[model samples]
Target: MTKPKTQEPVITSTSELPTSEAKWVTLRKVNYTDQTGAARTWEVASRKTRAKSAGVDAVAMGNVILHPARAPATVVVIQYRPPLDAYTVEWPAGLIDEGESAEDAAVREFKEEIGYDCEVTSVSPVQAADPGMSDANMKLVMVEVKLGEEDGEELPVQRLEDGEHIQRVVVPLTELYQRLVEWSEGERKIVAAKLFHFAAGMEFARKEGKKYGL
Candidate 1:
C-alpha cells in the first residue's frame, strides 16, 4: 500500500509582519530629575511585542564543572560567589557572557572556579532550565584533562574573573552528594555541575581500581 506524501514547512518573508519594514516610532523622549536629584531618566522607546506564539524564554550556557580526583581523599575545592546572602551554590557558570564562546568560557570557568585548565572535547545543544523565565538556558560540555596541582603546591582556590563573583572549592564527591540529598539544596548546586562531579568521580574510581591492577 502507498501512503500520501507529507508537505514541508514553508518559509515566510518580512512582508508577513504587522508592518512591511520594521521600524520603531518614538512615542516620547523622557528625561527628568526629582527632589535631591541631579540627573534622571534617559530616552526610551516602545515597540510592539512579538506574537505570543512566537515569544520564547530561555537560559543560556550552563555547565557542570568537573574536577577529577587522583589517588586522594581531599574533597578540596574553593568558592567565591557574592552577596553570600542568597547562597547560590552552582558550578562556575554564567549567561553565556557576550563575546566569549561556550567552550572558551567553560575552560575559563574551570580555571577560575577550580583552577583547573581543561579543553572542551564536546558540547551539548542549548536548552532551557527554567520554563517560567525567559532566557532560562544552559549547555553542558565535556572538559578533558588529567588533574594536577596549582602553583606546584596547594590546590588553587576558586576565584572569579572580572568581579563576576563566585567561589571554587573541591569537595569529596560523596560528601557533596550527601549534602545535596540531606539538605535538599538545589539552588547552591547547578544541575549540570553536579552531574559533572559524578561523571569525573566514577571515571576516577574506575582508573584507580585499574591502577591497583584490579
Candidate 2:
C-alpha cells in the first residue's frame, strides 16, 4: 500500500483524532447470498492495505452501562479483543450488524456482553478513529438505567472468557481519570467512547444526587 494522505476531514467538531485514525485500512469481505432475506458476515483485518487509504469502510456501536454504586459511579467491563494481546479494559462494543441502528446495536451489545438492557440518553457526533489510512469511524452513544432487573437473557459470549476474554467491573469517579490516562498511554488503545461514557454517567449520577440531597 502507498503512504496515506492526510487532512481529508469528512466533517469534524470533536476531540483531536487518534494517531491510529491515520493507519487503519480494512477490506470488505462480502458474503454473496441468493436469498434476499439472508444475512451476511463482515470481517476486518488487523493491518491496513493500500486500498484502505480512501477510508475505513466500516462502523461500530458501543455502550457504557451505569450501575448503582455507593457514590455516583459507573461500570466498565474489561475485555480483550483479538489482534491485541493482553487483556485491555474497554466498554461493551461491537460492530453494527448488516442493518442495525447505532443506538439499537449499542443496546444489543450491552445485553450480550454485559447481560442487561439500557436506554440511550445522548449520542456523540460521529467521529473517526483513524482517518487518513482508513475511513473507519465510530458512532459513540451514552446510556443509563436508574434501576432495572436483569431479564435473565442468555446470549452467546463467543468473545469473552472462553476463547475470548472479558471482565466486568465498576469504577468510581475517584479512579476514572487515572484509567483514562493509562489507556491513552497503553499501545492497545483507549477508545473515546469509554471516556465519554464515564463522563455521561457521572453527569447523570450527579444530577440524581443533587435531587436526593446526596
lDDT of 2 by residue, 1-214 (tens): 6934543123234455444574653454545554686776544443343223322222233343343434444456555443343345666666665456667767777766666567788766667655544345666667674443442223334333334345565555656656666765876555455455655576657667788776
Which candidate tops lDDT?
Answer: 2
Which stretches in model 2 have alpha-carbon errors above 4 Å?
Answer: 1-69, 148-162, 180-214
TM-score to true structure, per model: 0.45, 0.51
lDDT of each: 0.46, 0.53
How many residue pairs clash in all the candidates, one count each? 25, 9
Query: Model 1's lDDT to the true fold?
Result: 0.46
Candidate 2 — what's its lDDT? 0.53
